[model samples]
Target chain A: MLTLKQDHSTLIVLSVLADGPSYGYAISKAIAAKSDGHFKLTASGMYPLLTKLEKQGLVTTSWEEVKAEGADPDATGRRRKWYTLSPKGHKQLAKHIEANRQMQALLDAFVAPAVNDQNAHA
Target chain B: MKHTHGNTPKPKPPTSRDGIETWLDVLTSMLSLPSSQRTQVRDELEDHLRSRVDDLLVLGKSEAEAIRTAISELGETAQLARHISSASRTPKSFRRFAMNATFFVLAGSVLTASVSMMIPTHTNTTLPGATEAIVVETAEVTEPIRHRFNHEREPVVDVLQSIATAYGLSFRFSDGVRKSPFGKTILDTQLNTFKGEYTLKEAIDAFQARMYMTYGETVLAMTENELILMTLEEHKRMQIEIQAYQIPSWAESDDDQRNYGFSIEQLISTKHDLEYTTIQPVNGSLVVAAPPEVHAEIISMAAQLEAIGKSMQAQKTQQRIEQHAQMTRRIDRLRAEYEAAKSVYFAEREKANEFSNRIDELRSRRLFVRSNDELSKEQQEALQTQINNLGEQSKQQEITTDEAKARFERLQSILIDAESELILSDINDALPIEGMNDSKDEMRTVSIMGTANMRSGIYQLPEAGKLTLARFLMAADVQDPNGKVLLQRGGVSEPIGTVGDISSGTIDSIVLLPDDQVVITAAD
Candidate 1:
């Protein structure tokens, strides 16, 4: 799970983040849940990346008070600062998506007919 | 595939001034991170950590354990930092290149280009305040152009200080930090003396004696145990003085004016001592006998001693449990054996007694009937046999009683010895440190130039007190060549002699104390 290629990791993160802006915890959980118990991030690994993105101004932040139902009114609100990708982040995402699409097309053009011919022979 | 890689989530910036130094050391050592990158890395790491910790707490982990587990995942700080750097252009990622301690990364086209771009051209460099502009090239380290600037010109910023006039020139020396130059000199001398091969007391005394000679005619200086009065008045708080238990009087006493470490028991003794009560300018040479409790208080000082005594208390409690178990078994076994032997011996003796009584009754009846001469020979022989049986059983019971008594005495001796061993160990540990931890407060000393003379009169008599201890000493214990006695009496110690003292004779590192003296122990 850990030794996945860096490009594969980038794809996974983009897919998870596309749903909504989430803080470090929710985002990490989104990745794990979407992968169905395939991957997780250590705090050390995830936090630095979040900070780097914020530093790059590719993500913006907002604090939200998310209260659970039947919770004590006096208890501290589930206030968390959420992080979402900015316009620049979206543009960068689009470029990567295009590159991935081109790679996929190349693979389909070169290897699809060959794989089909082999299957037919069998 | 758009991933923000270099983002390290640090906890919100720690707002404590206290943790700066400690955290600096921790972070530097942990990451082996360069000084320049420290702040950014630390801030970012801290912010991310806080959020993650908050996340963990939400995820059902304890705040403490979550923080611990979160820190654990950092996975050898250096590697994680490198990975984070690859994700972004954070300075922590660029640390290796900045310090010029990088591997030959010829493959890094981007890094190579950036390095080339960073080196400034020589045309921009010039010497300050020189008519002939000296354009020095930093690119080539082949030549040197030393600037004629006064390197020692006082720093441009005096804005951080409130300057004051002292002696004549404007000075920033803290007058509040030192009451008198005499104290400053004494402490300075003491510190200097302790900086090398010197004992603590020797340093104190040598500096003190120098002070005595210098300021001999000034205010009366207190000497040794007579240095200050230890009293309950000093103990404003019930803080335990565990470091060999020497409570500074300045901290304890309401009279914080006097600055010196006050011995807690020494203070207690001052309050209890009649000498302190009678300490007025007396008319005669009064030999006042201090109360007997003075000795007991001194002895009781063993309680104030911390680490060693606490360990003894814990160890003795353990021993008591063990002794109780063993003693219970021994007593039970002895009692069982003795009871069995005793019952058999006594029962046989009882039968002999019954036979003897019958014989005596028969003889009495013969006498009453006036037929004393017609006694049967078989009856007389049977009475004799019963008398012999009675003697044997009595002897057997005596043996049983002696055997039981002997076993009881053996158990008693063992218990006594065990208890004694515990007491001795604790006692050896309780020897008061002569002067390693002196007072942190000020003493009003009359000064002669730079030396602090503590004696009221010139070279006043040092109040001698005996310090007897039971360490297995074969000399070589003290740092000085004082033949183990150090200094017997009024001799002035070596000038500025303060660092060395009675070192461990090391009758083995340590051992347990007896249960009885667990309340007061010296076993370190």
Candidate 2:
């Protein structure tokens, strides 16, 4: 599996949250599923990115208690933090997509010659 | 989707299984964040771990194996902690570059300089003066410059000029020496005593020594990046300075004030020509008049003396504190000994009282038997033997009581001295409590052989103490103990006793004390 760099990982996470609000585990699953098992974002990478995004005001977070079955109603259960993309985050994601597209076009200019040579040889 | 929460939710408490909990504990301990943030991060990670573990469990993995797989997916705990810490502290900008030693990238504004040498003359005429403007160009060399000069036969003047050119130095000769010189003096000298890697200072010193041996009246003076060969008499005419150095407070007494000047004079005279220097005691300070270089040496010497004074004061204070602590430890040891002896004394006294009571009772019984005339003679004789046996036991008890009393009195006397003791008191019976743990703190080797479950080799006890057979077996992780255990002590060939199952109650109670060897073999 390919490990994503910080900027790419941030762009992916922000793109995932653009659809709707989601928690850390669900976002990780979405990244893996969306990339078809080719990409993995572990909990270590997931929560810190979420925290940095929250600090930057690109994402806002809220907590919900996830009580286990047959657990005490009065007892506080495990907390699940949900991160939602802000309006600023939507703009940031748009900028990232445009930047990524420009980078790919510039890289393809260099790579196309090698491909054409391989095809000619074949 | 977000659910409404009235208050902040508490973190998930640790469960009994604790596999995931232990991982979180280690991960959180490495995070140098605020407690609230650490807790939030821990809870968030714990939730992620639980969700992953559940997913793995659904795919037919055991709870323990699922936890392990989930943890492995998170990568190394330390690396994860580092990432989280770096992220939370603030996003950082990183730059990376590489350079080979042969090539270095200089900044655009920096001008590189290369140095080239020019040797013009063999005579010491037109030497560079104090106001001479020397425009030097320095080149950056990655490696150290090594000098090697092997001359079978050469003029000293030519060799000196070569050294001056190679090391970028200029030379001057005093007027007296210039006038008295004659004939081309050919000498053989090996100036590279340090092979090839000698520093500039060592090379100059080596050449100076050779000059001194050849011309005993002349000395080489090196200062301010220049070398001067002059007779010892002419060196005193150079630049001189007079400075007043206030002696440190500890050496301000009359005798020390008188002697401090001589000490400084003695120190600098060995290395430099101190013929023009004079030291006089003036109002608790040394008024010294010497050359500028000698004055620099004197200032350095004064600083060193001040440091020595402070160090001596510190040492005295440290010695006092150590002496006080030694006295305190001795007192504590004496107190423990006194308490032990007191206990022993009381126990012996109680035993002696019991013996006395039993003897008295036996005497009363004998008197009653004598009063009852119908009693048989054999029964009376048996009663008499029992009374005699009780009397002998009482005598032994008295001896033990005396010994216990003596020990108690010895400790009491030491304790009395400890009350007035400014120093450590010498107490005879200063045994530690339990009287065995002192040796137990030392490491000792315990050899094991012919073991069915455990490896047959010398296993060192983590400590030197009375280790029981059961505890040793438990520590060694020996299982299926259906064997006979034998112990040997003091290098004895004969086995002491055959111990039964180490897991059982009665036989496992046997102690495997310090320096003992045990052999466990299967019952055939």
Candidate 3:
């Protein structure tokens, strides 16, 4: 609410966990993919968010090893941890998704509509 | 208490053979975080992670593997340690912590009270309107007695009641009301006397200050009027004694007089015409006019005092500004300092000017100036030159404020000496009550509005042909056909004697001889 935390960290954490369960490393990787190398939420920033999110009861956590579909790559991919969502976390994520969708819709409908018109006219 | 938040780093749980105790210890630590954060962080993390570990075991993972995976997913606890430790370093953080702790304590107390009230707990309950009975000791001393008391009442009231009890007093209890002593608490007990207990001297001093502060013109008018009236009365008595030929002739005495009473000159003279019956003078300090030197000195000393008062006020104002300057981090203080310095400089200059004016006034009134101004025609030009030179010297050196101040002090010293001489002269010049009393005894002041004649029992004379109510007397002219000249018998009562009834005759044509008495009367 205070914007005291970084938006990238919050977005990465929310989106990665939006699907199902994930651990800290998986969230970091997911953030990298989503930003397409444009942004990276560091471990330093990511760990603090996990702590705060857990404090706010937005996410619940557990531990499980990552298992590859085909041949298991050495221990790096074999036993990585995971974090997951609670019911409260699911609700928060839904709200976050809805807010993001509305913001995009408004941006498309109201803001820069003139730019689209100009392009069409040209 | 431990704050085992999610990012909180923990040393590896001791490999206790008793697993439950270790796990329970971790749970307890987890619960120690702030309540709002604890439920979310501790309970959710513990429950979710514990179930997840159980699930992993159910899915065939070992306990250590499950625990490790769960902890790793929660993130490193070192971050919590680092953040909390760094936050504790600041003073403001500690202040916030204290404020939060106070809020939590009050909230906890309120929650406990509400729970107890709803459950009707008997613990620590105070019954409504339950009066506490306490032992109250009563004692007495002399005029001011010391007392001691033990009660559930307020400590201030405790002391006050102790005092009141020492005097055998207490709160006056009434129906739904209580009353206590009006002057129960004294911020400082040293000050005891009031204006109601003022002495004559104190009253005089207070009256003097009050008169000076608020009623200056009134006091001045009253003072001048009293002095002028006394002088006028003194002159009046001299005139009466002179006209009656009952007073001693004026004789020049070279020595100064002390309290002009019935002097040796007045005691020897007598006349049958009139004599003083009796008199008395009030107790007063007759402040006679001082010699010119003494008067000049007083004027200068008064000026010096005024200057000193002004300079002290200016200095205090300057010093206060300086003190304030020490407190300033704000820019306005610089402005204040400049303003204060300017005011101090001007105030000092004004004091210097005031002293100069007094000196000039006194100098001009002195014998030296008198001689200079009243010099002969041949030397008048030379005197004027000297006056001009003195004036120039006086006006020069305007910046010698300290010199003026020192000279002001010198004038005060001269004033002190001259004042002593003036006070000493009071012993001779002032009319002491004894002397004034003697003069009053011999001076008869009779005020007659009309004629006085006793020869034929005819004194009041009524005027004719008009409703005149007043009367006057003059010597009658028997043959002049008009009563205008003085004769042997001065006047008569017109309504009864020596004049015809004007109502029945042409009275305006009446004439009288030289020795005839005349009476004039008027009535409305």
**Highest DockQ among the candidates is held by which one?**
2
Report the C-alpha lDDT of model 3 over B10-125, residue by residue, as the tens digit: 12222212222223222322221344443333333443345444444444344555555555433333333233222222332222222111111110111111111111111121
DockQ of 2: 0.10
lDDT tens digits by residue: candidate 2, B154-195: 656666666655555676765666765521232333333322
From the highest DockQ down, the ranking of the candidates is 2, 1, 3
For candidate 1, give the docking quality class from DockQ. incorrect
- Positional deviation of B363 in candidate 2, in angstroms? 99
Candidate 3 ranges with C-alpha deviation above 4 Å: A1-8, A63-81, A117-122, B1-524
Candidate 1 residue B372 C-alpha distance from true site, Å? 66
Could you say which candidate leads in TM-score?
2
- Candidate 2 or 3, higher DockQ? 2
Screening candidate 2 with a backbone cut-off below 3 angstroms (N, C-alpha, C), the clashing residue pairs are B440-B464
TM-score of every model?
A: 0.28, 0.32, 0.20
Candidate 1 structure quality by residue, lDDT tens digits, B1-524: 23343343333322222112222233332232344544545555554455555556455444444554555544444445444444444443232122222211111111111111211111211111223321111111112111121112222112101111100113232232235444354333321121222222232233334334442212211111111111122211111111111232223443331222234334655567433222111121111122223323432453345346556656755775475456446655665655665566556556655655765775566465446555577766665676566656656655665665565556556644554443333333323222221111232111111112111111111111112222211111222212222121223322211112222333222211111010111112
Residue B125 lDDT in candidate 3: 16
Report the number of the highest-lDDT candidate. Answer: 2
Docking class of 2: incorrect
